[model samples]
Target: MTSMMAPNAAGLSDADIANLAAHIASFGGAAAAPAAEAPAAEAAAAPAAAAGDVAAGKAKFAACAACHGMNGEGQGMFPKVAGQSADVLADKLKKYRAGETVGPMSAMMAPNASGLSDADIADLSAYMASL
Candidate 1:
C-alpha cells in the first residue's frame, strides 16, 4: 500500500491508511474466499460489495449492456466492469460525471455519466460487482 499510494495520488496520509486498516479489521478484514471463487484466470477479478442494492443495480445495468457486454465482459478498450470493486466503479463514475478524466475513455464515459445521480452510480456499481 505504501509503495502504490503515491503522495497526492489518493490524498492519504500514513495515519489515514492506519485508520482505514482498522476500519477493515473491525469487520474481520477482507475475506479470502472471494478470490478462490473464480478460476486462475479470474482469481483476482473479484467485485466490491458496497452499501448498494444488487437487485436495483441489476435493473440499472441493462443500459450498460450495449457496450459492456451482456454480462459486463468488456472487450478491447472497454474494460470489464463485472466483478470489479464497487469502490473503484463508483469512484470512476463520480469522476467521469464531474468531468474529470481518468483515462482515454473519459470523453465517452463522461457524457454517459453526466446525467447519472449518486444513486444511479451506486446502483450501477453494485450491479457490476454482482456480475
Candidate 2:
C-alpha cells in the first residue's frame, strides 16, 4: 500500500480512504492500514453510497485522462484510478477543494477540479469507479 499520510498528494481523505476500503472489500480484500484503528476499521466497513452519473462521469473523466490515462491505468507520476470507488475519488476531490491536501503533483490536479459541480463530481466519481 502507498503512504496514506503523505500529505495526500492525490488529495485523499478519511472518507476517501473509507470508500476505497469499501471498494476493495467488494472484491474480498481490505485496504491496508498501519493498525486496525477505529477510524480505519469504520472506513473499511462503511457501505458505499449511491451517487454519480456514469455518462456524465465519462464526460468529466475526459479531463482526467491526461493524468489518470485512458483506461485509468495511470502513467508517469499518476496513480491508478481504475476500479477505484466513486466515493473514494469524490472524497479525494473534496479534500483538494477543502485545502486539506496539496503538493506539486496535487497542484496539477487542483486546477482541474475547478468549475466542477457536485453532480459533475458524482458523475466523475462513478465513471472512475466503473473503470
Candidate 3:
C-alpha cells in the first residue's frame, strides 16, 4: 500500500488513524506504521512554541484581528485562527509568505504574512495555540 492517503480517504478520523497504527504495530510492521507520524510530527514541532513569546504574539495579532476578530471567533468571510494548532498556524503563515494560495483569504493573507520573520510567525503560532 502507499505510505499515505488523504486524511480520510478511508473515512478514518484521528482515532481511526491511531487504531490503524496499533494494528500495524501488532502485525510486526511497526516500522511501516502510519501512526508513528504523530510522534515524529510532534517531535519536529516541539521547539516551535518555545521559540515564540506569547505576549509578543498577542501584540502581533492586532493586524489579524480585523478579520479574525479579537477572540479569533472570525467574522464574515474570515476563518477562525484561535485554537488552531501552532504547527498548522506556522505552516499556513509560511505558505502565505511564499505566495502559496490556501483559499479565499490567500490574497489578503499573503501581504500580511510577507513581512513576518520566522520568530514573528512562531510567536503568532504560539499565541494562537494558547487561545
lDDT of 1: 0.67
Error of 1 at 117 (Å): 1.0
C-alpha positional error of residue 23 in candidate 3 after TM-score superposition, expressed in Å? 52
How well is each residue in 12-100 modelled by candidate 1, as lDDT tens digits?
56775575555434434332221122353542453333567888878667556545766999755577999988878987887787778
Tell me the spans in candidate 1 whose CA falls farther than 4 Å from its real position: 1-49
lDDT-better candidate, 1 vs 3: 3
Winning model by lDDT? 3
Question: In candidate 3, how many Å is residue 121 off?
Answer: 0.3
Candidate 3, residue 18: how far the Cα is off, in Å: 50
Q: Which parts of model 2 are misplaced by more than 4 Å?
A: 1-49, 102-104
Clashing pairs in 1: none
Candidate 3 structure quality by residue, lDDT tens digits, 6-121: 42235546775675555434434222211112365674757555688889899777667655777877766678888988878887887787778998778867756776767888
| Backbone N/Cα/C clashes per model | 0, 3, 0
Angstrom error at residue 25, model 2: 38
Q: What lDDT does model 2 reach?
A: 0.62
